[model samples]
Each structure stands twice: as structure tokens, then as C-alpha cells.
Target: MSTEEKNPIIKIYMLGRFALEYDGEIILEDEGKIHKVWSLLGYLLANHSRKLGSQELPELLCADERSGDPAKVVKNLAYRLRCLLSDSGLPKETYIVQSGGSYSWNERLNYTIDTDEFLASYKRARQGGIDEQTAIDCYLQAISIYQGKFLPHAVYDQWAAHSTTYYHRLFTDSIISLYRLLEKKETYELMLPVCEKAIGIDAYDEDIYRIYIHCLTKMGRHKEALLSYETITNRLYDEMGVNPSGELRSLYREIMKTLKSVETDLIIIKEDLNEGGQAECCYFCEYQIFKDIYRFIARRVNRTGESIFIMLCTLTDKEDEIPSKKYLAEAMESLKVSIGKTLRKGDLFSRYSHSQFVVMLPDISYENGYMVGKRIQAAYKKNKVSKVVTMHYKLQPLDPKHF
Candidate 1:
């Protein structure tokens, strides 16, 4: 403790990145090789509150390296770290303490860690009985410090899981607490970004979706709420093709119910595009909903003894030249209309990708499925949106497990 008094505090950041600052001066981070130094600092920071046994520290640090004495290697690393600290003008003894057969970051040193501050701020914010302003301030403080996960570099390391999970939960809790307080005052505009942030952090949390939907509803943005629900369903499906939960479905139903009152105006349209009564045919839905419907139909085929098949129609260029994006999008929309006219009323379909339309035809045998596919192809060919682009299709029987 002889020196380091001029700049007494060590500012170490551990929330998102591993950083060390003293007297507003950064260590050898901007220049060169300090990976081993970084690893040593991370381990000590991870187990900062208490000392790790000398043997255990070395073994943990050198878990992957074999053929050498871990203790000797760790001793050399420790000495190197001490020298680094000394060269940086910090009292080396105050930074790393070695005694009683253990090693730890010296508790007596004046240092601030982002992870520790995040926890403390969240704790202070949630200690009271939901004061909105104070809760907002505290949660913001915690969130401001959380640049990213506990240690982005060591994300897969087994040692990082516990703290990562803890910080993740704390972040979610902060959002919940702030929401609970904001809900009382009906401050949805303020809560909107918060919900979006939390969802960006953990999209798997359905409760946050509920709050987000509620916010949208309160703000009279019902369509965006539905879009958010679809966003969740789509993400869940993409990551793991799962259905929307009961809560989410119920929320969607409630929103639809709110929008249900049919307009009773003197209904006479000047454009009159629906002269053929809504152009008849398959039910169209979003890709995620279409996937769920496919699975639902698959589950019943075995018991009901009905044949169901799915088809994908994609747009391909007739020649070597690639079509522009505008033409591709125009072609997809035109193909959707053609398919809708060709398929039966009971069938289901969706736009599966940028230029692909997927259709599910139920209670149809292989022959009939082929007939339906041909009908769609013929219809699309008849009204060719692009002169050089054409429709290509693949059909297969219902495979429940595949869905």
C-alpha cells in the first residue's frame, strides 16, 4: 500500500466487457497481447468477494492446459500481474493478495465493478413498495451499466452460467418492477421503449409480451400489438417451431374481440374489386400461424384417416439473369392471388419466404394434390406477372414429425 494514492480507485468493468481504468488512463488494452492477463483478471473478478484456494485457482485457470505444473504456471502469471499493476502505478499488494494458501482481489483496495454496481442498483430499486420515479431511476442505472452479458467472451464457459443467469434475471426483474409502477400511472409511451428493450434482451419472456401488448392497446395501437404477437410467434417458431402459448393466444383473441364490431355504414363500394365475392379459396395467414395450422392438421390426419399435403411454390428465373427485388415482390403477390383462386375454400396458405408461397391442402389424395398443384401452376401461368419469371413447386404428404 505504499503508492497508488494519487489515483486511489481502480475502475474495473465486468458487465459487458473486461476493462480496467486508473486515473482515467487505460491499461495495455489499446496496444497488444494481454489475453492471459485478461483471463487472470476475469477469474479474480468472478470470485472477487472471497479468496480461492491457491491450488484451486491454478487448476481452474489452467483447466485446458496439460503437461505443466499448474501451480508454477499460475505463480508466474500472478507475479506478472503484480508487475503489471506496479507498472501501472497501483500498489500491487493492494490489488492482489496472496496468503493462507489462497488468492483474491484485495478487499481493502478501493475499486468499483460494474457487475457489483448493477446488482446493488437493482436491489435498491426494488427494495421499496413500487415508487415509479425511483424505480425508473434505479432500473435505468442498472441497465446503463449492463452493456452486455456478464462476460461476452466467456459465454460458453461453465463458470459463467450462474452469473449470466443471475444478471439476466435481475434485468428482467427491473423491467417488471418498472412496468408494475408505470402501469399504475398509464405511462405507456414511456414504457414502450422499456418493453422493446427487455424484449430485445429476452424475447422468450411471454409476460413482457403481454405488457407490451397492453401498452400498445392502451396507446390505441392495436395493429402493432398484433404485429408484436406475431413477432413473438415467429421468433419462437424460427428458433424452435413451437406454437404460441395459451396466454398469447388469449391475448390475441381479446384484441380481435375488441376490433370485432362490424361497420354498419351504407355498404356500397365504388371500386367493387370483390365482385366475385372475396375471390374464394384457401385461408391465408402469417408464416408462423400457417406452421401451427400445418401441425394441427398433421395431428388429426392419423386419427381422422384424411390425407393432407403441403406444397411450396417458388419463383425462379427462366434465364440466367436475376430478377430485381421489385419484380420478385410483385411476382409473389400475383402468385398468391392466383393460388388463392385455384385452391379450395377449406385449404390454407401463406407466404413462406420472400418469393415462396406455401399451401396446405387437407382431405386430398396424392392425385388430387397434384391436380391442385397443376391448377395453381396453370392459374399463375395464365396471369404471368413477370414475362421471364415462372412458378416452380414441390408437393409432399403430411409428415407430422417434420412439422
Candidate 2:
């Protein structure tokens, strides 16, 4: 359309998947009868936010063609599409108007795309902050509007590619935002599946890995969580030729300590268990217990890699959970003797969950990882099932190249 055209009117154009108006009107320009005309119009309307030259219009419409008078064909199709737009209630100033050799859609057409509405809602939600439930509601509403790939079946056109890129970004940002919001509340169980879906689309994205790590940690899947860190490390190293970010490196080390503590606690529980009562630790209970420990570590770790040496001990028996404070104190005292000497001055010790004792170590390293392992080993030696407590270790190198 002509950029110089004045007094243009706004006409909403919906072209994706069953073109229907916001007011419930359907606009179906027989694709079978006017393929060339529709293609040119779709191209122009898709680029409605920008201006295009008349010469460029034909080339866009006849992109796959070898040798034909694309210029003349574009001119004729533009004329027909313009007429169609007018007949279809588009004001004279609304549809495409002729410029020099080029054409431009009427900028005055106050048409709104579904995606625009989605973006508006998403932004509002993000800026609303943590206490704003409405923001999360709006963000989710926007996400739901993304029913399918943007402008599906538009073929290999450049305009379609642009739509694809835009939608991909929107989806990714929405996922990241949603994850961040939910993370503050430690809603890992709720957000895990959503994070996985986003990872399925863009596995290279670091945010997805971070979300996964958070979820795994809260769920007390320490070993599995460590594997995720390793995966990210390997991916960053092998592909980006870089090391994990400082935050991630620190998180990895923290998970290592948590893993060790969890193993020791499991051993204590198993030794105390009469039989198969160990499996009574359901995912829900385990998740709750782990979340408490994670929150404790997350607070102490704050912004340093120093918080990786945290550990938690939890009772595996579900039925015999209730006990006196004195009994608990004795257990805590025994745990202190077993692991306390190995801890530093600022290391945190707390009774986090119903049957869990969490220990936070602010600073730890690869060279000392083995030492911590040995110290934990000694603590477990007094336990009945010390030998069965498998000592699993996965060390992450600090070098950027190793990720």
C-alpha cells in the first residue's frame, strides 16, 4: 500500500487458521479461485506493520517461479486484492493503497492481531510483581491463546519465517517468566511439567535447565538434579565452548552436598526401619521435606557458590513419624558429632521438616569434595546400614571450557 496515503482507516485482518473476525464474521477469499491475489495480499497484510515496494510484492508472490513477468502479475493481483478488501467492509483508507511502484497497508487500520493481545497481557503480568496474582493470570491467558504455530501452512515464505521467530520468542519468554514467578513460591511440583514442555521445544535454553534443577531439588531428587547440572555443563562446554555460569557452578556444588546428606539420612532411616517401611516416603512427603531444605540453603547461599555443602537427614519411616523433642534432640546431637566437626563456622544446622536435619556449608571445593565425602562416610559408619549407603559422586569442573 501507498505510504503517502492520508486519512487511512483501520481494518482488522485475521488470516491465520480459519480467518474469522473478532466480531464473529468470517472472511474467506476463495483461495482456489484467487491464489495469486490471496498470496500477495497475505504477504502485504502479514507485513502490515511495515511498508513494501511494488517490485518486491511480485517477487514475494512468485518466489518459487523461475522466469515470468512477476512485476505485472503483482500489479494486477494487488488491484484485485484491494478491491476485495474494499468490498469486504474495509474502508477505502483501510486496505492496501498504491504508492510509487510499491503498495502499503493502510496504517490507520486499527486492526489487532491475537498475538498483540497476548503480548500485552504477558507484559502486564510480568510487571505486576510477585504479589500480583492477576499478572500470573493474565500471563497464562496470553499463553493459552497460542493455539498453534504462528500462521501455520503459510509455506516457506520469509513473512511466515518472521512470524515463526516472533512466536518462538514470545513462547520462550512467557515460559521463563512463568517459571520465575512460580519459583519464588517454590512451586516446583506444579511447574515441573511446564518447564519440561519448554525444554522440549528449546533444549539449549539455560532457563529451562535452571527450572528443572529447581524442581528436582525441591522434590528431593538430588542425584537426578545433579545430573541436570552435569547435562548443562556438558552442553555448554561441548557446544558453546564455555563454562557454566557462576550461579550454576555454585548451584551444582550445593546439590552435591545435598546429595551426600540425603544418602546419609536414607541410611540412618533404613537402619532404623524394621522392614520395607523405607518406601513409605512418598513423592509428596519427600518433595515437601526437600523444599524446606532447599529454602534453607537458598537463603544462606544467597548469591555465592559457597552454599553447596548443605546436607539434610530425614526419617524414612512414615508411620512412626511422631516423636518427643528430647528424642529428636538426642538424634540431632548424635548427628552433630557425626558431621559437625567436618563443618565450618558459618555452616547452618536446622530441623527443617518433620524428620529432616539440614546442614548448610557456605564454602566447598573439588579438592575438599573427597574430604567432605570421607567425613560424611564416618558419620554414616555409626549407622546400621552404613555399608549400603552408596557413595555417588559427580564433580563439576570450574573451568569455563569444561562447563
Best by TM-score: 1
Candidate 2 worst ten-residue window by lDDT: 279-288
Tens-place lDDT per residue, model 2, 190-301, is: 6676666666556667877887886798789988898887677655643444556667766776786677453557778777554455433212212334545556556545
Give per-model TM-scores. Answer: 0.67, 0.44
lDDT of each: 0.75, 0.59
Model 1 per-residue lDDT at 144: 71
- TM-score, cand. 1 vs. native: 0.67
Judged by lDDT, which candidate is best? 1
